[model samples]
Target: MAGGIFVVPLLTLFAGASFPTAVAVSLVSVIACSCASAPQFLSARLVNLRLAAVLELATVAGSVVGVLLVGSIAPGILYGLFAVVLLVSAAQMLRPRRSAQPLGSGWGERLRLASSAPDAGGVDQRYHVGSLPIGLSLMFGAGTLSALLGIGSGVLKIPAMDAALRLPLKVSSATANLMIGVTATGTAAAYLILGKVDLVLAGPVVLGSVLGAVLGARAMVRVNGSVLRVAFVLVLAALAVPMGLTAFGIEIGPLR
Candidate 1:
């Protein structure tokens, strides 16, 4: 569930990257992470392509807006925004989510977004997509945040998937990973064209992301869904502290 957002905090805390630059570099890693993990997720049947396709439209549009606005947002405000996103995501994950919509509701049925995922015991647990409008709105915000913060928006996407769309955690995680690459691509390209991406710093991040994604994909199927949710919450909450502090002009690491 950490997905590519993992790289952002690492870059900021240890690599001396400013939040904006860290976000830009993290965009590259997000793509690498998504691509590297796709085969495993697809084969496992955990990805919801129909749901992803509909959601990507909003995410992609928001990313364009984010790229346009990235230059104007202040660093302090970026830090505060990151903190709020992290805290909110962590809180959201703590509560279990399920699709309240009936299968016969035909909401997601029409979109073909209702699906199933294997439980820890290897049984298929069926679910339906709900609140697509809410999901799309959140996804639009997530995409803009992805471009501005460089966390692949997985930080928000998974929650949007689980809470608004009512997908199982495993499915939400996998689908978010699947969509993350596409979401990051547009913003990453814009940053690269604008000379905002630091190739020197990004190379190692990409390598690590690829390796980490491979390992994570292999481990995901075996892990419990509840464990996965808690794991992400902890990491996100931990990162929020440092980001919040930096917003207040305190520093725990070197700043660019």
Candidate 2:
């Protein structure tokens, strides 16, 4: 799951396994991501409980629905949608994010649902006010994508928080990492019930992902993501073409 989202799911596909095998392997990666990023999220004070709670509501709801719909939908249709999402994500990552400004005048309505939290810099900052509906909708979308693709929506979540909700990249990334495990819980249940998981293939992927997540989290603090974002976009673009072809039932490969 971790490598698929971070790099590409193509490797797992090359292993000649079913979709369940890929999701099962990806779940381990999700666990590792949570374990690796939770500490930093706590230390940075970016948990945003209210926002997470609201988002979870939507995510859980959507995941349940997604599971129900999975059996009815064609695999090609699902993969085709995922390929589109991947391309959009790649584009979003490549562009520079607009800076977030404080919501000053809109403080009254927001104060009821929104709250203040300190950043790693020790300043209490204002977050979304009265935006639960919008946030929940976003999470619902994330959950749908998760169930459909077997990839965590962290890529989408981070960008949404940073771009749509006006959150700092650091806080957004931290919060996104924190939320993945919870979101996965809902979808994983659905996947499990549907028999869409493989233990053996999942084991090594999870092990490698946890170790990799720890390194990725640490690197997030020191590295300038500008270059990384560009490279990631290029990688995503390259992957999208083949994914699109595959989704349309045009087989285009021999092996990884």
Candidate 3:
């Protein structure tokens, strides 16, 4: 999440890296962050493998389309798009969540996407997954954004899983952490082939991202779900400032 969401803007605005170079670094760092945090989330039984598999189908396809559009789109437009995405995600997170109670006869039962995770009190909280089609559509959009902006799509995925699928916030977060690595792999390869990867810059970012991911993952399980939701919205809104201004060609001097 840091790599994809925070790294790119920091690199582009603060470090004076080109957008493409920053994006490439972001993609690689996303893999590192996801890989680092995935095992912890899995062990905690937070990831939904079945839902991930189904949603990923749409995501990967959208990513491919995003990769193809990269060369044709202008930098200003890309920046604007990124800003729009961040703002939209923030707004969605700030909204009241839908009831997560099971629908009893929807995609959850048909595809067996429902599962349980331990709550803060260590109770196994069973949750139902619904609206497979809506979730899939949002995931496809998320995948496209991931490839185009190199933010791992977690920003979008979490909200989509909540608003569309009625998944718990922790479940959405953990499952998204699991899915981003796979979503970024092909996009990263495409960037690499286009000679966008700056190994010298990516090396340090990847290392920092991995270390941060480990710490963040450890802290996540202890955080209250309501607090976490508020934090997500705040972070998204904060990051949107520099990116939004950048869309209009204003430089905020390194966001560091």
The prediction achieving the highest lDDT against the true structure is: 3
What is candidate 1's CA lDDT for residue 244?
87
Model 2 per-residue lDDT tens digits across residues 187-221: 66655677766766666777777777778777876
lDDT score, candidate 2: 0.66
lDDT of 3 by residue, 1-256 (tens): 5457778877887888889888899999999999999999899888999988988898899899888888899998888888887888777766777655656437668888888988877899889886788888889988898888988877678767887888887788888888888889998987788787998999999999999999988986677868877887887778788888888988676463
How does each model score on lDDT? 0.80, 0.66, 0.84
| Best of the two (1, 3) by TM-score | 3
Considering summed lDDT, which 10 consecutive residues are worst modelled in model 1? 98-107
Clashing pairs in 2: 1-26, 20-196
Off by over 4 Å in 3: 223-235, 252-256
TM-score of each: 0.87, 0.85, 0.90
Spell out the clash pairs found in candidate 3: 4-151, 14-254
Candidate with the larger TM-score of 1 and 2: 1
Q: Return the candidate ranking by TM-score, descending.
A: 3, 1, 2
Question: Candidate 1: lDDT over CA atoms?
Answer: 0.80
**How many steric clashes does model 2 contain?**
2
